[model samples]
Target: MFRVFKTCHLFKQNKIFTRRMAAVNLKSLSEDKIYEFLNSFDTVLTDCDGVLWMDMTPIENSPEVMNKFHDHGRQTFYITNNSTKTREEFLAKCSKLNFHATKNNILCTSYLAACYLQDLGFKKKVYVVGSEGVSKELEQVGIDHCGVGPDTIKPGVPYKTFERDPDVGAVIVGFDEHFSYPKLLKAASYLSDENVHFVGTNTDERFPMDGNIVVPGTGSLVRCVETCAERKAVIVGKPDTYISKAIIKRFNINPKRTLMIGDRCNTDILLGTRCGFQTLLVLSGVTSLTEVNTWKQSNSQDELDLLPDYYVDKLGDLLPYLEKFKPTNASATMLKFFSKSLRVSMAHMLANKENYERFATQRSNNSLLAVTYSLSYIRIDSKLCNQSHVTSANPSIIVPIRPDITEYEFLFTGNHTMAASNLKSLSEEELKRFVNSFDVVLSDCDGVLWVENEPIPGSPEVVRRLKLIGKKFFYVTNNNTKTRAEFLEKCEKLQYQAKLEEMMCTSYLVAAYLKEKKFNKKVYIVGKEAIGKELNAVGIEYIGLGPDPLVGDSLGMIENFNPDPDVGAVVVGFDDQISYPKIAKAATYVQNPDVHFIGTNCDNQRPSPNSNIFPGSGCMLRVIEAAANRKAVLLGKPEPYISQTIISKYGLNPERTLMIGDKGDTDILLGKRCGFKTLLVLSGVTSLKDLEKWKRSEDKEERDLVPDYYTDKLSDLLPMLSNS
Candidate 1:
């Protein structure tokens, strides 16, 4: 039960409460981590105003982020609750700010108000207690509206003598510069007939203020009408059903394939929860981490609805990942590491200061450089500070060199810093040593082995060689859309040998996760029959598997909806049969407060055989997230849970394990976090340019995305394996 505190002191007391649930902070993660999160959504529904701008000034890099989504073939829409602006006005602002948008991609409160009235088939006039934006939008839909001009309250005016229009079948409330007592009286008089509808553009309690001064929101006036007429108004904006239905129907959006990015949890995150879109909260706007923590402790379901699936410090931080780059000339590079120490003999070093200074000056002038470490102490002239070589008694002292020295570079390569990449190709001797170090191999299926459904060159030979040599390998995939049996069948078709136990997929991991947790309750499934089958195999019953075909008189299902008490969890994956009823049921079941939420994987796009894009499981998972207002335990790549299971089940040693994958964010990031050596194969997704960006980044989080090693393709390892 949700408790409304009458006193401010009780509300303050609520802040200190503790809860286990928390949003995953995407800001601190590597570039690969952010990429995995972004790839899980097909459509992006973003809130404007605070998220993209502070009133007028654009938030840094927001425009580029939206454009990047478009470049990646993800759909985007700007949804706002500011009813004062018409569609055209919003478009003008978007254009000025360089936000990549179109008329079809913008969804505002005024436009939603017009859509709601049209859906209602209300031919009669609407008495609007708002601005010209609402009236203009209503006009576009061929619906007549009035009450736009000033209706200011006069001191001597007789309130009882106010006239009403009989043709006014509805009262629409929005932001109004001319709102007065007379307009309220007129609107209430018309709404007295319970048949006359009352529509509110938004229910925001207050507008974001500049300082101490707070402006009243449209919700204030909507309350006045409701208080007078004793009837609840239909809200058309965020956290409401009207806009969600409109956007879904207009765009034919798949709920399972959409994302909602916003700053405010109450409106933006709440809307996402209602629509089943994955929500990303940014701290660049209205919400703070402290407010989210307070919500985490709340028992109220409404408070829970405000939680986002993931959050970033700001949207602009994604710029470094998306920025374009061109690789430098690779011919000039040289391999550097040799036996953990330089081969230069310290006995040959000159102890004389003048001799050392002259030698250092000549070497510094030349671009050619070599780094040597010695325990012996030697002093050089202070004037020769630009010298390439510096001898110190301190073994830890590192000699600094020119920035343009690309022939050989010694980057701080470790678990704490970004993984260093070899600028040059690997030698035959080096490849053999690298391949011999790992005892177990964990490989990603889609990109590493095949692109679009066909096996890459030399990939099959490499896998066969590993198997022939008795190397233990696991085909780990975030492809929860298909079952392990299906995956094994695909492997057979591709001529790649695999055992059922050797395949680790998100679906199987999800089932294993539930079984390990000892959860015996039935599950509400928002996915295909394959997921249901997996659950059944683990003795977990499930409902809402296939499409719940829409019926003409289906309002009864919603009105009389009753969730099963035995249903203790909601698991979401790719569901071709997804429908309104399935979403309703899953959302309802999850609302029980005790029902756990689980997602197979957060993969948004699948690589098609023809190179076309298809929605992945993340879409469906998002839909349940929006409706249930809860986060899911993701059992897939980049999420530590799946890796933990694989580690425990196979008894694999992280120190001697190599994780090979095409995508760096999911496959490589997963390997890095699991304490395994990661090798990035440029057979798909991440490019050499992408790797260079992470390597050059100052942000430690972005630097963490760099892989321990990289190769042109997985096939490059075949020659060394064959010789072995």
Candidate 2:
């Protein structure tokens, strides 16, 4: 059946042939081989869009080939990632295109979404970010839903005034032309509750379109919601195992005996390979023969999995093969003979397995060799097969390692080869040169200057000495729980020299931002009294300062919600009394596209006594961000706002300024981003171990957290600069 030609001249001479390349040209096989390939499978699953028809036009002879499969008693199923149509609509299209299909045979994503929820025993309403097809499918399953059509943002109507439906407990993302900010807001708001379920129909980034025109797919919308909600969705379409699970549960088909025919390798071929089905790639759709060949050459397992077992120029090309293998009374006897011959050949090969393995190992060490048969394919590449026991003649292939170096030491040495230098390791002369390199110093408060009410030993003295040496010092803290004056008072209490103008608290930064914008509207506060006081200093009216706990159920709260129409900005900071009502109100106000949303800081946690972890303002800000489905303008350390303000106001050269702190992510990263010299002290949040971790991190952001220099504590610098 597999006609092995002495000279491979029938195909293109320029193309290199390899036994590992599984995408065999179906036309290259003999007539008997084609018949055996066709008879190997009893069930067929085919993609609809590009294989059967492209939009409305059917490919030539494709319908006849598919219909012939049904005629041959093969169970046929139409699977698609397109969520824009219902099963009934798909069936109608199939009928018009001359492809015989019933509702049971169609498996569109919209219908699958409904089935997914139904299987979960979901009784609550669904918040749909899709089209009428999805809503219609939900209707068929007796599921309540909303948000199908255009829900445009109205002029002058604040999003805070919009009421939330109490019954909506799930959000489903699919393709929708009317994907607006309002829909994203509602969907994210519902998904903010951890109890709410989230589902995505598919993750195809875009649709296949002609010419240079590119249309975004449902994946774009799904990603947007996922980003705002800060959660992942359960995908129910191709490439995911959910569709196969559904098919297995409903039909109980044998994966080994099933044939998957598709045009796309990423979704179709990948799904088939994952499900243990024989894959046939049609070149008429999204994939091409050149792309298949490229995948065959790749060493990556992911790329290798994309290669199909067989490929043809088009689905219509299979018509000739099917016609030649038409059923007859002699077909059964021929199939029996073919099966008997395969068993006998396999048994014979097994008898000489030891000799074959020895030869394979010898050949693998010399060169890459593969022997593919019609029934089974085996590749003998030493690089891929892990035959470590086989000796090679080439001595260069063996890599020697130093016995003295531990694995951890080797890895750490490589990872930290270009990491930050230790400031304490510098000589007294070098330390003096480093001290004189910068004229201005920006210091963080909590971790660097002091921890809570107690100052780190000798830190105050170091600050005083730096100032005495003519260095311009400023206190920059992300703590928004206190006003600038209160911070200055604390600095004085801790024996640190500071002035009113030298303090740069986040509360002051928020007030300054609004004042510079010349904003005249009232501010909605989701923080403590310090923010309100700062706004008062700038002559800005503010509300929502104290406790505003939830009263009754969420439904009643929404019904009686009365948003302040005059409010124009929502400011988020640290709140000791953060409540559901405050978060809900802030989210609602920020939803209005015109309203400014500001976050004081993004610190996840703060240092506390007795080893207690205290949640910071970042936690509260994320809650509001998730509910509003929008990012807030950050004004804390590492965000550039503080550095930009200081540079603009004081006319300090960034290259000549030094930033000293005890946190790498905030303090040191801020200095790095602003082009300031960074010095990390281990007297507070960050330690020497944290620095080592950052130096070994593969993430650029984490690596950037490494400071220009590091020390055990702020006091360590005092001994280095004693003479100076």
Candidate 3:
């Protein structure tokens, strides 16, 4: 028989029995759906500022409350959405509040946001919309910031606007009680109209006062402008995954095994629900038992997704609510929450904090259990694009009918992800099936097809498979500066066939777009002379930036050419004349932001035979883009320009396009971020090993980095497409 250790009040005289009861209570957790959810992870992630504490002090009993987790030997990382303070400051606050914390245990969003901006290549003049704290935080990362003071650009000030000068790139937002209509309107107008960014400090609606009322917080200001602009404010505050991710990055907290405990449902509960943590709502703070009772009574409460797994008056008071907490060691109650009966009740039971958190742990990644209770608008199973089959023994569990919204199914899954090779292995029937399900394909040159100028396994056969089937495909490569004729010739010599039009190298598109821009000045050609020939055809003069760049170099023109103001664009490509003299001159010209700095493409490097290591166009692009402190508009594969070209060439519909690639950074992320369904292939570039590292990261931006579908190789995906 299962031991029901209902309450600790029963064990005052016998410490051993109380210990036994604790174990028994833990056992009951496995048996009871709610207990299992509470025990799913051993780490707790919490946010500061508006979460655990207010401005200078913690919410009542927050320390004694958090001590319960510490006593359990669970890791606790205090994550803050604000960036102004360093770990030292956080630890000081923790000490003051009696919440145990070390520098390592604190993950600050200000720190992470600064790092994120840096990684995305931002280190320029910053326009901040917060107090001094926001500006000071960004400055630590060597980022220059100009605050919202009157001096930067005041009334009656003639400042440079976008059409006149586009250098003022970033606009960061934070809480400011002094936010006026004039200031708010300008921030909204600028952020909405151009590429200027809009980032917020946090999203807390109102801060809790010492009394019953709440004070409007920074989030209210952010929402006001964001609503006016019709743009989603990039939150840098609590409950934002970006902040939660800092714990994973700094302390290596596995999101799969983390829990968040707090009192308020809105802040603590929201963090737990969004950050993929087990949330325990303690009724010792602002939220009350009456509210829960009222929500249940009225049947009008919402955000059922964010409901906590367990409800207790306090951490020390949990022994009473654990009526179902402790059970016999052998009790199988934990598995009960995972039963098919749960899914049916999921839609209704979610609003009940006690019921929702219990079974949420049983949910698999990309499964409904984890997401069903978080964002109401997010369909947990929607990404899979398949009808969910009801589980066994839960025959009465009415599966929710699919909504009328556009349904998107995962294109490849299960065994289909294992057997595939390049897209060509698909039979004619398979080809039609793939084209039916997917509309675009991205192919590479080099090792994917040829190894050091020799055809690899299944070269022409793959090309013919696509040609015969007439599947829309583009030769997407990082190699820029080389013309279409060059890739086509290489294809013919290597026993693979490709047409000039079918070839979509970054080199040709960039050169063509530059030519069309009609800068009509001297081009500082950094790559081979052949690249210069194409530019020359567009009526632009080319000066050699190197010796013997393959396309053309007559009079040591590359090394000796002094850049003239007439030098419209310093076009950097893969250059063999990679001598010190060339690098210095090119770097000098790029630093002048007024000059047009162009790179062939953004690929860092590529592997090959003999020399084995050669710089890709991206490496060259980075050099110029960094010096200018601006993101170069890439004209290559999956970029809108390239996407447009590909779509127009094959008359392919953009919505139907599917980009298949092995690397998540370049291929999957590019395709998906560009609004195409992406299928990550394991055949080249990316691997399972890479995904393992990516998963351990706290970067929330990586969320979109996931592939719509994944496969060991492209060949395996054919069956799924054909079957679909």
lDDT of candidates 1 onward, in order: 0.70, 0.76, 0.54
Model 2 lDDT on a 0 to 1 scale: 0.76
Clashing pairs in 2: none
Clashes of each: 11, 0, 32
TM-scores, all candidates, are 0.48, 0.52, 0.40
CA lDDT, candidate 1, residue 241: 61
Give lDDT tens digits, candidate 1, residues 1-724: 1111111111112222121234678777766556555555668888887788877788999999888888877788999988988889999999999987888889999999998888878899999988888999999999998898766544576445565677889989887645444565577667767888899998764455343223445665565456545477989988776787788788888765677888888888877765556678998866789999888877775576688878888888777776652222222221111112122232243233444444444432212223222111222233233343444332323333334333223223123336555513777777778878898999998878987568888888888889888788898988776788988888888889889998888778778888988998888887766677778788988877764654542244454566678889888876655554565576666656677888887765455343222445665565456444567888888888877887888888889998898666678888888999898887776778888777766446667678889888888777678778
lDDT of 3 by residue, 1-724 (tens): 0111111111112221111100012223534444555455567776454346756766655676466666666687776654446567778888988887777777665565566677668855666666566666677778887645432224454222312114546667665433433344356445644576677777654444443222344555565456444466677666666666655666786654676765566667667656555566666554666655554334222434345655655554443333334323322443442231112322343334333334433333223212232222234344332233322223432223234323322111111122222344556675555556654566655444554556655545655565555566677765664677888887777776677787877667656777667676677766776667677667778776445221222113333545566766677776644332343345456556655776655554444343222335554444334323345566654356766666666777656777766556666666865677666666555566666545543344554556666656544543434344
lDDT of 1 at 353: 45
Least accurate stretch of 10 residues (summed lDDT) in model 1? 1-10
lDDT of 2 by residue, 1-724 (tens): 0111121111111111222326889888888877878887778999987788887899889999999999898899999988888999999999999998899989999999999999999999999999889999999999999998766656678544556688998999988766655676678778868888999998765555443223446765676567656688999988777898899889999776788999888888878866767789998877878888898888655576688888988899989888767654344644553342212232233234353344433332223222322223222232322233322332433211133322111111123433477887888788889999999999998878788899988899999998888999999999999999999899999999789989999999999999999999999998889999999999999999986655674335554677889999999998755654676678778768898999998875566443323456776776567546579999998899999999999999999999998888789889999999999888777878878888876557788899888887888878765767
Ranking by TM-score: 2, 1, 3
